[model samples]
Target: MNRLFPVWRRCAAVWVTGGLAAVLSVHAYAQAPTQRPAQSATQSPTAWTTSWSTALQEIPRIAEPPPLYQAPAVAGRTVRQIIVPTLSGTTTQLRISNRYGTRPLTIAGVTVARSAAGAAIEPGSASVVTFGGKREVVLGPGMEMDSDAIPFKVTRGAPLTVSVDAGSDAVMQAWHRIAGRVSYVSSEGRHAGDIPAAAFNVRFTQYAWITRLAVSGEHKGGLVAIGDSITDGLRSTFGADRSWPSELSRRLAAAGATPMAILNTGISGNRLLSGSVCYGDSLESRFEHDAAELPGVHTVVVMIGINDINFSSMPARRGLDCDTPHKVVSADDLIAGYRRVIATAHRHGLHIVGGTITPAALPPAREAIRLKVNEWIRDGRAFDGVVDFDKALRDPAHPDRLKTSFDSGDHVHPSDAGYAAMALAAEGVVPGAKR
Candidate 1:
């Protein structure tokens, strides 16, 4: 294993800002993220705060892909999507990412309006989304471009509708799969400006080219939750927002303490140190763009490494195995990965909260690794804070399995109650996130 941070040389000196305190990492990075180093953001109330964001994965190009992974064709058509922002503001920006596209993506027009119903927008709230004052945009491959700030009123938790009319050559090569929320796609021609739901005849549960919705307002800062399926709200009630992050967001909003937008960057089947043909890049490699450098992000909560510890043990399938590379990893390797992630966050002046890995009903050997990782999370004190999700959802008697009431039937992910419990434990670690 590479010594990403062969030696942990964390300095005791720390600075506190906006209810968030962060340590400065004056160390060497042996193995850094695949992207460029994380840049420090000038986070403030007036800066662009990412209120809604998604982590993207490349659509598999195998012989056949599951219907869920098959991206809808968008050429010469308007696609309307619904998103509920977590922060309220008077001005907002929309970001379009062609991060994984093989070719340039062109958009003819876009409009933003408050969502009135499924695929329908409020009659008068439609606002044009532009880039440099131009309604049309040609986004280059691997590029992420943000629309000019549009003066639109938005309230926290209110669903906002975004309609896009990608030019005749547009197609989805990258998407945030498993979006739990429904998005509408038009049948033939441009309907981005349509007020009726008849044009948007198709519905899908994945986010397309759109990447982020940011706001400028009196927000403390934003929190990013990055990791695997549990963090991605898998198996939870669709469109119900029962993920631990969503639950935590609701709890904080109700408590009126440390009010900040929470962004979910977790991809199902995501690994800490490995990649998947369908699961996106390794969380460690994508951390810079997905979490560290996100606009207005002051804190991060990571519940990862289970995949890294388990993928190696699974047998290869006869068909297209997304879990191929199946790289072997140990507790030491995961700890090293966490250290690198921690250092990256600190360099960006963000507080990182370590999440103790949850139980997955693994065999004794694999179970031991999970326990060791949790021990380090709870006692290593390397992160800014720690959230003991393992303790929160673990069966008191079994000690290594999910509590019956908290199991999401798979015994791997968490149930709605389990996720809520996780949010309760997470509240204590987030600065000022009181119950």
Candidate 2:
């Protein structure tokens, strides 16, 4: 597979020769704070500026809730900690989406607190999020909005809380990820907008509608992981930092990359194309908003299409539909859909890396479709690079279903260890890139 990195490395080395030649001749040793950082010829030499624009306008209409029958409930569930590592010299703005809500939702308020506990957060240690303007927001049904940017300084692996207060009728659609323990912020004490970290639990008794998070920084852009539950780490143990994307970020930080942010935009039961199962349109339909619309997204890694086959096969398996008698989703359709996703990302100047659908240890009928789809995804050059999750998780003997240990029992989503392996395999595809 002819790829992007090998060629990029060669091109980058050539500039070093030219840069050293200029550095030796310039002898202006001025000791001032106006010193500038070296910039590559291909890079722009402009001061960092804060600007806002609407990347995608979500459809604002009351719709139906997703398949709660098959999906698990989130009630009485608590995310111990959310690790939000940010670039220096910037504030983080959070984006909440309600694309699948059945009624208008109102977010009473939110809090960003510091974590006292390591990794996982304990109850009663979070606070509120506020700024100069209004703190509360009223989001209509099926609409997505951004919060008033919260100005705060953060370090790597900083445990934080983004607790939301939802309206009574809010049917909050949340993306499930295994966030570790974090501390919470407190309300304004003697001075407003200058609340220090405290151990008071900021409680909210409403629904949560947080879709995206924007960290404003004066460095490289961010990476958005767009796909289904696999990217969302559905079967991965709750409260464990095992999601591949989460592992990828930790690896990037260890590699000394500046401000590399990751936004996991995976929804359970989602597909690359529209489906009746996942409440919203296909990955192709939501690509613009989910992947490209973040404040700064430099790359996108996509792993989807499994649910398309599974759901498409469901009707035929039950002898309910006549269109797909064999209950098989053709590779040709999946390939075409991949091309559309790649082309769209390229249009936004994003480096798109395709992820192979992990081997599903399903019945023989479904396994055949999985193999065929994985074949096209692996060999297809439509993507800039391929993350071979199939190779990473498939059992050696079977070559279709994941190994028993890696399998999440349903044979669709991966276990925590399996997701970590996939993330480790995808490491180099987006190396040293910033957010």
* TM of each candidate vs. truth: 0.90, 0.68
Question: What is the C-alpha local distance difference test score of each model?
Answer: 0.81, 0.53
Q: Residues 1-435, candidate 2, lDDT per residue (tens digit)? A: 000111111101000110121111111111112111211112222222112111122221224332332222222222222445534434655555555555666655565555544322334544455422555556555655554555655555665555554444343343332222222222322111222324233422211344444454465656678887788777677556567787787777776766566657676666776643323457888786666544456667889978777776554433222122223456678888888887766655666777878877667776776778777766555566667788888888988778778888877778877887776677656645432
Q: Which candidate's lDDT is highest? A: 1
Q: What's model 1's lDDT at 72?
A: 82
lDDT of 1: 0.81
Model 1: which ten-residue window has the lowest total lDDT? 1-10
